[model samples]
Target: MSTTDSAPTCPVHDFNHYAELPYGEKIEFYDRLRDEAPLIRNEFANGHYIVTRYEDILSVYQNAKTFSSSAVTVFNPNPTFKWIPEMLDGDEHRQWRKQLGPLFSPKAVEGLEQKVRERAIEVIESIAVRGSCDFMADFANQYPSFIFLDLMGLPFEDLDTFLHWEDEILHVSGEPEETARRRTAATIAVTEYFRTVIDARRAEPRDDLISKAIEFEIDGEPVTQDDLESFCILMFMAGLDTVSATLGSTFYHLATHPEDRRAIVDDPELIPSAIEEILRAFAIVIPSRKAMADTEIAGCPVKAGDMISLPLNAATRDEAVFDDAKEVQLDRSPNNHIAFGAGPHRCLGSHLARRELRIALEEWHRLIPDYRLASKSAPTEAGGQLGPSGNIFLEWDV
Candidate 1:
């Protein structure tokens, strides 16, 4: 294995061990990795390749033809099931995305913003009276989960199932036997549930995403029910969990950094830029891509089919890209971090995700003007698409 002589040296390539590190410490580890081996390769459970630097991440984002996103999820390869659109490359991916794109476009999402804001307000107001709550469970989790469910026209009572299944799919660790069983069960359950929704929507169409997807056509043929169901499952997991995790991390930053919090609160207009800064700083999702053919990136040799994990959370903090990259500066101009990722496979729900975050900051602060940490309890972090987890306990005078 090749190594770089730099300020922060690389640890022996042990991704499993690295995944177990606490949130902040993990960020530190990736920072060193970015500084030393911008295009360094490491040994992972499956394989490894060049984890290029901040600039490289942007380049890879722009040049999707070379660094394909079809194999975005890093799995044991033996798993029985996987989502279709997320795992397709080239023309196939284009077809799937073309069929699915219109639903999540800015205009389409804007049509749902009223309902999304209402849901956000409802959850925020529910906890406002308590003056103390776990921001993740009470507000962050509930808000996006509800928005996703509402958008899909899913059953309101199915929120618990949605949350549970999403957790199982994202966090694949601890008690391998139990995790496997739960994941399998959740997959079967959710797929069957969506299948039923697709049938119902087909028979009697509604003004919801599922219904639209059911009737939507590419060329002249309506989308297959199987494709619609698969896309539905992907939306449930990605739309809900990714936004929830991002908002959770953003709230934690704002609570911890009172000055930064006050800066946004003082100037409501700054919330948009503040959202961008927060997304850039707390880009917790570590995106993985498979090298299509043996290629060279930033002087690193990558063989065909080698799995490459990009520590985007780390790259966003690279000093070369942003002046004072570590600090939370809402006024930072021309911020171009790939929190939503880059390339042809960038997040379709990014616009909706941003809107949700903006609403969370603007409304939460308006309702609970004075809030602080419940205690000095530290935050928990995790790897993969999910960032930090656990309760962000906050206390405020009602």
Candidate 2:
């Protein structure tokens, strides 16, 4: 019952390889790490601290000054892309966050909800009749991609290109050189594509976030093209992958757990609670923060420039906070889980994400209430942003 455990004696080599492990195995491994080695030093390919305990992770996330987010990689030191807004820490981070804040507020997102719901329905209806479909490709991936495009006012024709680019940046299964090349190509493509969109928005203003960005001035100066493009790219990748993964994970959990499905379906009013519970349980995103200066977190010494991976998933499921930590109770009250994250770096798109989840659950249950996973096809093992990327095939009676 002690949370102040020392680093593990057993050297954890190839920590990055944990990303490739099966979902169930990964969960088990994380549980063990949280219980035994709260501050384990991951000397795998990348040397970093693997923070597993809930208190430790929360402490790191809250102290933005101490734990910076401006590092190359959020999780590890080696990063393929250069520093963007999400990577910034301190006042620079605050400035960038201010620029992007109003763009995802409840008012802003509420204005976009109609479009999002329409897009969600369109994607959902396309495959609902088949009674058997690749949920990831057809719905999970499609829904968020379309929403992001609409938010940025990008051409719908570019959805496939965006998907491919996201896959490349996120999925690193191939050779190191090849993965790096693919990531570079994706970055260039995304930057160029958004740059064009920004130009178009400037020439002919429209009622969209990109257009607003063009008009928006920080300190009486128009937002720079580089900043706009970077913001757009961040919005696209961040909005799409996290929501899609959450949707997929939600479906995966409900489909497998008939009792949970029945509980939600029976009351329907509990859908919102169900969404929160699912997010709490399947808390994806192993967000990282850097130590801006020497600090002690949960009594563990951390130095400046050290990369710290806060396993949000492990923290949400921490036994210290939640009763029956492993169980997924739809009625779990006063749930303060940090699935979207915490402090100044909390996800700005949370309201939108919640809307999507609520709409998705409502519509999905209405369309296919009795769906169950297929026995033939295996679950997706694709990691990265959308963990378990394989098609979540479900069989239902039409």
The numbered model that scores best in lDDT is 2
lDDT of each: 0.72, 0.73
RMSD of 2: 3.8
Please identify model 1 stretches exceeding 4 Å from their true place.
Answer: 1-12, 17-20, 50-52, 76-84, 175-182, 218-220, 384-389
Off by over 4 Å in 2: 1-13, 72-84, 174-178, 381-388
lDDT of 2 at 133: 80
User: What tens digits encode model 2's per-residue C-alpha lDDT throughout 276-350?
Assistant: 998888787777776767666655666777777787778998999888777899989988899988888888789
> In model 1, what is the error at residue 201, expressed in angstroms?
1.9
- By TM-score, how accurate is candidate 1? 0.89
Residue 386 lDDT in candidate 2: 46
How far residue 284's Cα lies from its native spot in candidate 1, in Å, is 2.1
